[model samples]
Target: MKKILIVEDEKDLAENLRDLLEALGYVVVKVFDQAQFVLEYLKTEAVDLILMDVMIKGSMDGIKLTEEIKKSHPIPVVFITAFSDQGVLERISKGKYEGYLLKPFSLQALKSAVFLALNKHAILEKDLEGASKNSLKIRDKGYVVPVSQDDILFVEADGLYSKIVTIQKTYVLRGILKEISKNLDPKKFVRVHKSFTININQVTSLNAKELVIGEHIIPIRRGFYKSLLGLIKLN
Candidate 1:
């Protein structure tokens, strides 16, 4: 069974979420309104996912707490926020959360978000575990080619398809950029734009706007520059 942690301030809502998740076969742990308690619990236990409320009781809000937790634990977090203000949305976008649910969400919506978040996290974890020997399998004209992950410099979205660029060649795969990115190792690849995911190990230079992998210059989307910077060391 997958373990899930709920960080909501409302006792009633938290209980409801716990009941719903538990009924769906997940082991749920509820932490009502305490950011410190959540952090402390994480130190002694492991969970597959976290359902975080935006305005929990603490000096650090959900977005800030999520950022802090991600610095040490890469556990996927799905924000459950009632606020839809521009400020809140912008802040949430800047954070490293997997998904979000707005106020008064339906049961089905909650189910779908949690399921997708957990599923995406599972794919990422699987890819990370296989990072040492995993190769992206691509179908060519008649044969399937195995492209080693380390050899990939970047992946670019081409409408419905994605172009996987390696050191020597590029292959087109029939999948959208978002779907393809979830299967890549997050530690090795970062989505710098809506249309580009690049290998950090292969980056030669980077600035506020773009990054270079060998001879190719990949544009960094507005909000993604910070994400890319977080993966690298600075002087």
Candidate 2:
């Protein structure tokens, strides 16, 4: 069973969330309001996802706590906040979180968010396991072939299929861009456009609009620029 941690302040709400998640077959751990306790618990136990409230009884708020957690753990976090203001959202966006739910959200919405977060995290863990093998498994002509992740330059969406471009050759995969990208290492690859996901290690140069991987110039969509920048260091 998947484990989940709920860092909520309100006792009643925390109990409700725990009961709901437990009923759904998840192992739920609740930290009433202490950020420190949550951090300490994580050192000993592993959880698949975290449900954090923006405002909690601790020295650091949920946003800051999440930031600290990301530095040490790659665990996915879903923010539960009452605030939906632009400033609060922008601040939340600066952190590495998987999802967020505004106040007054329905139980169904909460369930969906939890399910999606867990599913996405599962994909990331699977990809990380593949990365440890130093190659990606691709289906080709009824056979599974291994491709070096380092050799991959970029991926592009082509109608119903996604093309994986490598230094040697390109492989046409039988999935959409989003589906294909879920298998790549998040630290090594990033989606720069709706139609493109590039290997950051292969990037040669970048401008405000596009990035270069050898001779291939990939367009950087408006919202994705920040994500690409976060993965690379700028001198």
Q: How large is the C-alpha RMSD of every model relative to the true structure?
A: 18.0, 17.1
TM-scores of all candidate predictions against the true structure: 0.57, 0.57
lDDT, candidate 1, residue 170? 88
Tens-place lDDT per residue, model 1, 73-112, is: 9899999988999999999998788899998998899899
Candidate 2: segments with Cα more than 4 A from true spot: 135-235
How would you encode candidate 2's per-residue C-alpha lDDT over 10-126 as one tens digit per residue? 888888889888988888865658789988888898888899999999689999999999989999999999998999999999878989998878889988999898889889889
Q: Whole-model Cα lDDT per candidate? A: 0.88, 0.87
Cα deviation in Å at residue 201, candidate 2? 20
Total backbone collisions for each predicted model = 0, 0
